[model samples]
Target: MSEGFGAKVPADVERPDRVLAGLTARQVAILAATAATVYGQWWVIGRVVPLIVFAVLAGPLVVAGIALAVGRRDGVAVFDLARAALAFRMRARRLHTRPPGTGPAAPGWARERAHYSRYPCGRTGQLRLPPHAITDTPHHPAPLACLDLGTSGVAVIAAASTVNFSMRTDTEQYALIGCFARLLHAQTGPVQILIRTHQIDLRPALAELADSLGRLPHPTLRAAATAHHRWLSELATDTTLLTHQVLLVLREPTHLHTTQPGFTGAVGSGRRVAAVTRLAQRLDDARRTLAGAEITLTPLSPEQAHAVLATCADPTRDPTHGWTHSWEHTP
Candidate 1:
């Protein structure tokens, strides 16, 4: 007899090496169980008579199970993949086509409406909405009416730098907390503390370094400077450098009445001066208290205050830095 016809087939033919090459033994077992359950159910139902027909019906389930198992091995969950697919589809369908009657180059309002309608939550049309001037919200509070002692009340803005409480001993931390509480208690009116943390901009520092490097004479120094610049450029792209700003808002009570008997009429400059003087006194007291607690407090000028407010309201803009001008009156 010929060896191919009569001899037992090789073991490799019975259990092929390529059958489930990438899958672990456990994954292979699970897949086998899934296929068996699907086919066994079909057989019990007496609906699928042929193996080919059963495979046609059950192929999708097997493929899906295998895909899920492979994704799990690669540290990707099925839900995450589904969400990413959905997001991609949504993004892909976000474009808009102009209406038939509209010209090739539509008006600005029509373009905006078309853009808005592409999303489910978008408003209908620009014509139905209020004018931009009226609808636009102010990014920052309106410049204080009076610039100094507005109608609301006399207010002051000061930035303070605090010590690292976390690094201190428990006793020091408790003492600091107690002192801060006393400081708050000492305030006669409302006090608000606003803490702002922003990514530090390294452009100015890099520029300075570049200028210094240009001044150097040696080639070795220049090569080192180039390497340093490259490292700093990479570092600047990371969101690692952060700066914290603490703003203190103190509002002083307004005195509408003056001691003078004739003050019953319109308030005079003297009364305004007195109110301003009281505000100044309160600010001085606050500065002293904070200083005693080992905190450095610097008052913000009107321009600096405006910049700070704008920076906060819209984070896309850069804030004015190193403002040295002091407000002579009210800011």
Candidate 2:
């Protein structure tokens, strides 16, 4: 096929074209820059340096330049990988739960005694992390259902129900696809669909079943419930039962930066309310639009959102319904 004749969306849309010798412009630039620098160094000081010593130093540098230009690690260029590795090494090794400048200060004697902390960098200085870079609860997380993604704008998550498309006929599938396409076309802002699989802990379920066994109307029903509980108990002890959940994330860029031309209009405290209302309306519209496809979108409450985030952060831990992750000022 000719270059412009392709219909399918290319997988790597950001991929740069190879201009010379199967090397992209960026690769060629890296190689050229490395060669130029090496040659410049040789031209300036080559007379004083031993021939073998220059060869040894220049050989490794040239090899590294070639590697950086051509080699890839995990689909990332070696240059990028090295830069990331260096960045990782330079960053703080530990993180404190507390944000900078809060909580009671240590006593003078205690401060003197513990002048050097085990991971002083994590404690003494502020290392920028998530939730901190965004809204400041003074950097502590507040009970916000939606995250104010700062420059990227505000975002919210909704628990969405899925449709069993595989069971539908071709005609039904096409209809559903058309409905879905309409949903996509109607989008006023960016939207994301995330599917997460979680393992169910059947022990608690078995316990609940065990508790309900005696409440059964018939002895036969009670026996069957007891048997089912035993089976679940066995399964819990043996293997994991996984269930997939669909979540819808809606995002709208506030363009709230005062310097930006878009922000010439006022964007103060009232902006948050307007943004949230807009998000909710969008979610509702999504719910109504996807109704034809039998997909439901239920906006998660702040507590439920926390639980979902907590669960996603650490899947091994059980989700809490009643727990409130508070970050209110403690004066």
Candidate 3:
């Protein structure tokens, strides 16, 4: 129901106590470390020590074991796994934090600010990207999308659109296949394509629609839907179906082409739109071909597109939309 610091909440409910419990997460880590060190050292030394010396070591071992037991009840139970996950998140740059509170907050930053009183959110107690630092770029990549262009040069990842092949004509499908091959060849360099598949749980959307339907003077559609659902449920007992949503990402080289020189006075805004549209059209055409081949092509949303471009983009010169598929010089 709410998103904060790159985290998602399936429900709007909040348990400040649950978050504060994480404060003890660090303790599990410390306890494990302490146990390993103390017990390990004792065992190592006891191997060579006399019976009396070993007995002495056993005393400390007993104390350490008791401490571990207390630590577990005190909230260090998931310490190892949680700490490792946190470390991985930091390395992947996916770390986020949330503060404590009950009221609804702003989407990201303001929401984070709202939760500040509850728990320390964000890794290292800092936001991943500063508010002003989030910028608009040419090919907006998803916030979660990352691009790595080495020998392949360019990589663009965004949410994509999916088309069902079962709906297309034979000729259209063949044309689509050819178009897809051409699109792949058109890549300026090695391209890494990643498709992220998720589920579309339209329950919330349908529920909202239901409220509007309820207000309708006519109950025809609502009644029909209810009947349909009832019949479907009766027909298929205990059946669960998965709805798959797809995101398409294309990674290639960043290339620059000849353009009119000088800033502001060079190309008019109309020309820029035309050019972007033209490129989009070509890409869309190719996407249709890929669709025939059962490949889903989803362009990144504006913000996500910008993020992807920003990650691999060079600031020296503006990259045209087409440049998303071309290679650029790496300094």
Q: Order the candidates by TM-score, highest first.
A: 2, 1, 3
How would you encode candidate 2's per-residue C-alpha lDDT over 141-259 as one tens digit per residue?
23335655545666678787878887887778777888898989999999998999887757667778888887889999988888888777888778877999898888877666643
Model 3 regions more than 4 Å off:
1-135, 138-154, 158-173, 225-241, 252-298, 302-331
TM-score of each: 0.45, 0.64, 0.33
Q: Ten residues in a row with the worst lDDT in model 2?
A: 131-140
What tens-digit string does per-residue lDDT give for candidate 3 at 11-73? Answer: 534322322335444445555676677677767886688878766766776566445434443
If ranked by lDDT, best first, what sequence of candidates would result? 2, 1, 3
Clashes of 3: 36
RMSD to the true structure for each prediction, in A, is 22.7, 7.8, 18.2
Question: What is the lDDT of every predicted structure here?
Answer: 0.59, 0.69, 0.46
lDDT of model 3 at residue 48? Answer: 80
**Which is the leading candidate under lDDT?**
2
